[model samples]
Target: MLNHYSLWKYLIVILVFTTGVIYTLPSLYGDNPTIYITQYITEENHQTLDNILLSQIKKILENETITHKSISLQTNKILIQFFCEKDQLKAYQKLLTIFINKYQIFLCTTPAAPYWLSVIKAKPIKLGLDLCGGIYFVIHVNTEVILNKLQEQYIDTVKATLFEKKIPYIKIYKIKNHGIEINFKNSNYRNKSIIPLSKINHGLVIHRIEDNKLHIIFSEIKKHEICERAVQQNSTILYHRIHQLGITEPLVQRHGIDRIIIELPGIQDIKKVKKILSTTASLEFRLVNSAISDFDINNNLIPEDSEIKLTNNGYLVPLYKQIILSGNYIVNSNTSLDEYNRPQVNITLDKIGSTIISNFTKNNIGKTIATLFVEYKDSGKKDSKGHPLLIKHEKIINIATIQSQLGNSFRIVGISNLNEARHLSLLLRMGTLITPVHIEEERIIGPMLGKKNITQGFTACTLGILTSICFMVLWYRYFGLIASIALIANLILMISTMSIIPGMVLTMPSIAGIILTLSVAIDANVLINERIKEELKQGKPVQYAIYTGYRKAFTSIVDANITTIITSIILYLIGTGPIKGFAITTIIGVGTSMFTSIIGTRAVVNLVYGKKNVNKLSI
Candidate 1:
């Protein structure tokens, strides 16, 4: 019942809507390639690194004024764009390395820039470990140890408070299954202690006294809280560590209540990363023995703690602070080569801890302080002294006067390599330099796998579209062939859409989106084909069937696609990354398909059937 003219009209509409081809020429030759580079960073080095990248980009743009340029910056991300010629891709790649290599930048290249335009805005390409192999790590978390540490803090606090209140009780220690046991000499104090102890809630579940001892049981709710805290602590630790390591786009997130995820792209030094992540940089400060001379203090009086044992070099080997400031007061820290070309940590203090630090420095201004012992985690390698050592210690105090002069901020001078200095900064930032904690879990992906996966995925997608078109035309006749053409157009439009959108990444998931769009475009043709068959069966005139079929089917077509549009919107809003790409393409495809099926397809059909007489159903 459909006419040749009407069918031609629908075909054109579909082609225009889906392909953005406008004509056949642009469809094949419009594509071009480009490359991007991401630079590594530390709190201390990001500014210098960013400036270098910006300067290089500015120089390039000065020579060539590329239209449709864009730039954006966030807390830890940067994006830029320009129209690029395919031949210039190699030059761009070299320019990126030359400008950003010193800042530890990683490079990425794409045959097309899809993340700059609005129609099909591509996201920033996420470089997986397989395609851009980087620092791979496996951190085994000591959860039991972390929980015990948490419990210990609460117990210590309660003990200190009871002592201050003169509420004398026998020794208190942690019991099995996460409870505290107190040996009280007086029954009266034991009953009174329960009410006072109820206030000590550091994520602990306090149970009533059982079997002549106080039983503490951490319920599921409490356990979950503890796990969450551990994850937060782990995330913070990894963030600080990666920040210090100067890895850009470091993915650090909570995996489960008990685990964490950290991905540092482009970090190839496994040993260095392992060493930095493994070391617990515990920093402590203790008052000097004013009674002894600097020489005597250095020569004798060993620290009791095994982690801070003294050495035999006529100077105290290692000593920890008895009671000094914690590293949490350090809001920011960075590493730099000193005047002597040795690595040093330059730290900045937050306001809450500044008062204490300012007062400490003011009081110790002119004093020739004795050995301020420093400890370093041995890299598990042999030292020059040929000892099977676990840790290293230094008792030098050349910087005590320097520390006193810096007010709230201070510097730790004298370290071997840039890696060591960075490690020191990570330790301080992770809060392990002030406390004790260990890595819980880790995973790493390399660039090779990413490239393989992406290539295979794209190949499969192309094959799928070709096969789909072959089947559609073979099964549905002339109308099916028209639909297939439109579907191809739809794909071009989607690609071009992405090229125009900023921050859009043409990832593996986005290929899936293109397939979804193809389905939607074909579905519109199916609707029209079915409508034409119904009119033909009803014995309507060819021209009447053609007009009526499209007019009557128009409402259903619009309604169906509109409902799908709403769903796609919701999906786009809630989904992350890949899912969002699918939703965007699907929604756009549906809208475009509807117009082409109703209008363009009708025109083509009318043109074909306008003067024909004895019509046999072909579409």
Candidate 2:
């Protein structure tokens, strides 16, 4: 009766073990090599593939004699399963040539788990880049561009303040990397402008260059703050974009002053990745220069204050240089159809942007405003510093009259098709980069290396677990066998818990954590076994020794595991990349080990020896 457990306790242990085993089933099924083909929208053409396109792809594969396991169609995408990676690669190259500019084709692996397992939301543990093999990118942010933009804004502020305060100045212009310079007629006007200009921005350091000139520059602290903010903003936007792509466990983090390191595990679409990461797409709203008539446009005559921008239809239109609003303040966006059944992007702005747009539209009703779509592209040229040169591309996406005083929301029409509309909406919703970024370094880890890593990790784990089991059994006899069983259960429970937890990626170091956990679990059982031996040496009955041994071991086990959990948590909080992955597995492993080493082994021991009236123990 002393070593016996209640019916409810046995049921709970059984239920937990059963659940662990069930969830762990999905990982054993592995993954299948597959190719995914999705829609790729361009400015010239924006169309989604249909079943007809799927049929054509299937026929092309057949003509090429490429063996495929199955071909299926999903929403706006097609999937082709293959028997092996060779077939998958072959079919990918074949389809990519035919659909080069139209469709996005990429090779990836899909879960081969049973339908029933997936229906219950059971999934395998996510693997890190080192384990799964993918792309690594070291990107450099152009902080100089951000500083220059800040200088321009400060220039605008100085001009606005000078005009408002009735201060006279000859001219105000930016002095490249230094700051803004204000030329005045005399020292009287220059001295008068200093007070108001100094109050414009907290970081501005205003100084008089001469009797008729003043210079304004940002302080060192302010410049550092601006650069840090821009780098952090770029990192956040990149994270959002990668998440929208449905990538799991992507590593996007700042490396140094102006660099970001990104690890995309199991993703093979290099072109798409570069396009999404490097693109700084945004929108600007400006009033169209209606003063220039169609006749002036035909003669290519443009006003000094306006610039000619080509529309998506290849027509040139003049727009004012003043921007009323920018996409930086856009909070949300979605693709929708207008009243005329044409594609449009419905945008919702933040409070500041909403107020700006409302006041502007209220005062300038009936004025034509143009939506400018802007993007920064790599020019295939490098500067003196060996950095890639970025060319700015601007197009007039829409030009329409202000019909009403739009508040927080508005719609832009003239999108070429639904696909383009959707693409634009996605970019706006995910937020735009604060500055341009170029790939400073790129490395592609092939699937073969990943496979080798997996094999080595598996071998290490199997050997560690088997060695632990043998040691435990040789030391404690039948009780050691019970401890060994509990040890194995700890592993299953750990893996299942990792699978259930979102964004938990398994790396090589994670396997090391698993092995370490097994040793700790064995140590716990050894404590119990030693305690029982001590109790038996004191002339105690077998049942009394068993119950007292477990009762005394509980304190030591909890204390040890609690300390380990705390250490793992600290590592998790301070670590990055693979260190975090290792910490995560250790925390999970310690938790599962606590449950299995104590509660799990106790249940098995009770069933084996609890009710028996024995004069001697197996030990």
Candidate 3:
């Protein structure tokens, strides 16, 4: 009878201990300092690090007398391992001197476990930014830029529609926030333009004025939609940029209609991140206009149906007004090398963009195509001498004629170096930022501080558990020892369950959840022991008291835990970030407590006190 275990009880214990261990093993293996390299290598490069780049890295390491462990390129990341954090930093510095920003490098603390462990799909818990040493940024979006861009697009659409319908409009002028106004020579032309303009889908109000003019303005509803869409697009763009950096579990979220929040774990250098956050990069494919008359590149002259674009070199090149394609159509872009081993960006288009490119290229096989690189930076951020750290407007990076008709995919070569290729491809692949964003707030937490927080938190948790164990054992003697054992088991079960939860991040608040659950576990044990003492005082035998005590305590345990479970679920549903972490830990801990308090303690009590001849009650 003492060894009795229903099939369910046997299954529960096995499941808890076995799973708890498998998920917890990775954390115990410890961490090594590794360098994460985001090279942005595209498939078009048709190259791998092991081919050319790896050899160069190895040569540098060997010359510098630096030791390394396993080196690999996975998930578009170059992970170079080292035995000590000191060596990792040393190697990182040495390599930076040679490469000079060829890649985005992160000196990260990576899992020191063997390849076999990773092959089996075991990973350590993801810690929050505060617990792992990282940077936090609160950025505010420029919604006015989004509105003006939309209005410019609408103006183009209205012009094209009037031209297609053969409606004679003398001129079209933009009226800022009021939208585009068109002047017609006569009332007949203005009335005719109205029917064609009615085809606009994005909620525009068109009116005819006494001056034989037509005005189109965005409706209130459309303006709100544009604002919402701009914020969403900026969030999405920022997400891609973060992912491209190869940072794990970095948080990119919308804070308000015009604000965004970014949390990057293990990033110490704030200066390296500020430029990427503030600058907006995009791409344009326009036809080269070589027939234009040669003019002074810096005269600030304006030409008809053409624009002067400053190339990466000092010369300004003329380009047609019509853009053949834009970065918005690109679904993916990556770094690669050309036939000459020169760095290049390979771009892949979405279905619609592919069709547009296929039709255009098919018609103009010998035409020259120019790839214009555009970057918008904040003018307010300056260097020491009051000069802008970056050019505040668009610059054309490269231009080449089409060799043959092509579609779907193409490579942009002539990048100055590998770093340029990586950066250009990264920006192209990430699409465009709908508007500029300003960093409203920024914070950096060092790794030493994060480690200290972890230490103090765990020390507090351990001291609390140890103190509880001593109290339970001292007060109730033998039965209290059994409760202490169950309390240890409760801790183990709670940790194991949390380890297996997908996307569960451990924060300081999560530790609080576990501490609260430990108290609940102790309360459950107290309820059970007191019920047994009451049964014995009523003159019940030892075995009968055990049975009645468990039967009486089961209802209270379920009722107490279930109410807390419901509240935790509600908190998890409404909460975000750290609050969700706390809610999750609480939910898992409550279930583990129920198992350890009622079933685990009872099993030990049965083994020790199952004899029928027992007369004296320990409690």
Greater TM-score among 1 and 3 belongs to 3
- Candidate 1 per-residue lDDT, tens place, 19-52, comes to 4543222323322322333333322333333555
If candidate 2 were superposed on the true structure by all CA atoms, what would the RMSD be? 3.9
Q: After superposition, how far is residue 486 of candidate 2 from its true place, in Å?
A: 1.2
Question: Which one wins on lDDT?
Answer: 2
Across 301-329, the per-residue lDDT of candidate 3 in tens digits comes to: 54444778888886778887677787778
TM-score of every model versus the real structure: 0.58, 0.86, 0.80
Off by over 4 Å in 2: 41-45, 58-76, 176-178, 184-195, 203-215, 219-225, 243-249, 289-320, 329-356, 383-385, 407-431
Which residue pairs show collisions in model 2?
A: none
Indicate whether candidate 2 or candidate 3 has the larger lDDT: 2
Give the per-residue lDDT digits (tens) of candidate 2, residues 128-177. 77788889999999988778767766766677788899998888887855
Residue pairs that clash (backbone atoms under 3 angstroms), model 3: 42-335, 45-336
Pick by lDDT: 1 or 2, better one: 2
> How many clashes does the backbone of model 1 have?
75
Provide the lDDT at 461 for model 1. 68
